[model samples]
Target: MGTLIFNLNMMKMMKYRLLFLYILGMTVAACNNDLPDELFVKRVVIAENGFQDLRLEYPEDGTVNTQITISISGTSVLSKDVEAQVKVCPDTLDDYNYERFVQDTMLYYTLLPEDCYTLENEGKVTIKKGDEYALLSVQFDLSRLDMFKDYVLPLEVSSVSDYEVGEPKYRKALFHLNILNNFSYVYTPSGAKVYNSGDNDDYTAWTTDLTLSTLNYNTCRMYAGGVYETDTDRDKYVIQVTVNSDSTLSYTAMTPEINLMAEGDASQNRISISESPDLLVQNKSVITTTLKMNYSYTYTSPEGYPYHRRFEGTFTNDRTVFRDKDGNIREEW
Candidate 1:
């Protein structure tokens, strides 16, 4: 009887010890789960400044090949090798889809086919061991896209092997591309001479300097005889120029009245300029235009003299080529 009791006691003690160990192990595991993960993306660095919107201006060199560099960094020096999958997918969000995504919390994005640009890397990126960051090279072809439309290229880190992805916004890099077709430019005018028919040779019609500042992507304000100066004494004239869909350049005078004199009686005598059919030209870099000017004047005299004069001539202007301080050509327009 003594041996049986001793054996039963030993078995019960052993079961209790095993149960205590199991509970302790579970508690330890739960405590460990509370700790944060150490591996994460530290920051994403872009090579160019103001790259968040990524507005690509039309290249003056006329080449479509342009590239931007991006780097992915980790919080600490990586101990083990890590791999990430990246893709350049089109932003398929239409007006309705975007609205729904904003309104509904459970919605996810669905990617559509990419039609506008070409990527050089086939959209794969990797970071090896001992490397703090990974570098990505992306080249965009602007010539393949329509200059008038808006496009987007979303560079996404789809998955990571050893480390957790960074912030939700940083995980996917969104590049909004807007192609600006503004053809406005500053030009030097030559071979421009004024012709007067109504005894008012004081009013010169030729433009020695001209500037076309863009009002929008397609239209511009063509100014002659100074920028933003509208006083009649300065002889300033403003015209509206537009770049049509067919790449043709056209212009119409915005201000029709050109006061010859501000204080004298000749102020009553003004030159009225009009261009018909919207002067069309093919080349933007250098252009020669012939416009007809009608000069109508009513002098404050005893005879009540009224004179109508017509002047016509050709004027040539060349776009001022932009250059860096080193004298290298930066742009044409």
Candidate 2:
């Protein structure tokens, strides 16, 4: 009896294992069926008016013919009834005046209302479950500008199932162009200068150092780097000036010469002007001054380096002069 019972138990275990395998196989087949076959877009057709190639001219004043064709192929979805709807919404753009939030939505496409582009002639087509390929077509009208213009068009595709699929998506078609502009420039640029002296001789006679006042043109400021002074004493002052964009500048200076001799060492012939004179004459005296400047500018589009300009002017006032008290005039000054 024990041997018979053990054999019976072994047979029962084998039967149960076979039953589990059969059920598992059926489950897998069911899951596979639940997934839809893959659908593909094989070709896209763009109508003549659809895209404006600025490089290629269509009928500038009239219209042009345009169309789009799409091809598709896949295995799993062939057996199922598949229908698609094409929606083209020239994405709405915002042209606002608000400061904080400025949005640019360039929607430049013209399509029929109801916002749907149906494939003409062939509305619904059927494919066998094992079928490998299919095709879809979309058509539209495009208007041409009399002169020239810029525009953008967006195309979208999706499955039409009164039932929900996943989400809708689209691709963008870009177009750009330029028309005529009629505005005019009312103002023009001219050269202007600032100076301390009028003649070259006085320019050399004046002190080497010269201060530059803030310069302005049409409310714009200028910058500089190099030292600027009379050409005569160019070594004494190293003035660097850089003018800002859209501006021009000029400068001038005046300097005076001095006669001095050494008192202690007669042979030395110390010819120089006193650092600080006791008397500064207002009229009928000698005084010198110098001027220097730099310029910088820019353009609407990318341009080469700025145009650099340099100039000098010097002059002296014979009426107003500086002198020491002693009759011995200041020499080498």
- Measured against the true structure, the TM-scores of the candidates, in listed sequence, are 0.38, 0.25
Model 2 ranges off by over 4 Å: 1-77, 92-147, 162-166, 170-333
The whole-model lDDT of each prediction reads 0.48, 0.30
Writing each residue's lDDT as its tens digit, candidate 1 over 1-333 gives 999999999999999999999999999999889856555545443334221465555554433445555445655565676666666534523333466567663353333236545555665556666675666655555545543234556666666775465554556555666444344444444433333344546445555455545445566564433223544433234555555565444545454543322222322222222222213532222222322122222222236443332322222333334445675546543
Q: Candidate 2, residues 1-333: lDDT per residue as tens digits?
A: 999999999999999999999999999999988865544432222222233432212232322323333223333334444454444445521111122244432233333333222344433333233443234343322232222123333443334432222222222232223111110011111122322133323322223333332111111111211233333434322222222232222212211111111112222111111123335442223322211222221111125333222222221111123445653334312
TM-score attained by model 1 = 0.38
| Model 1, backbone clash pairs (residues 3+ apart or across chains), number | 0
Per-residue lDDT for 265 in model 2?
Answer: 26
Flag regions of model 1 displaced more than 4 Å: 1-51, 60-74, 89-115, 180-333
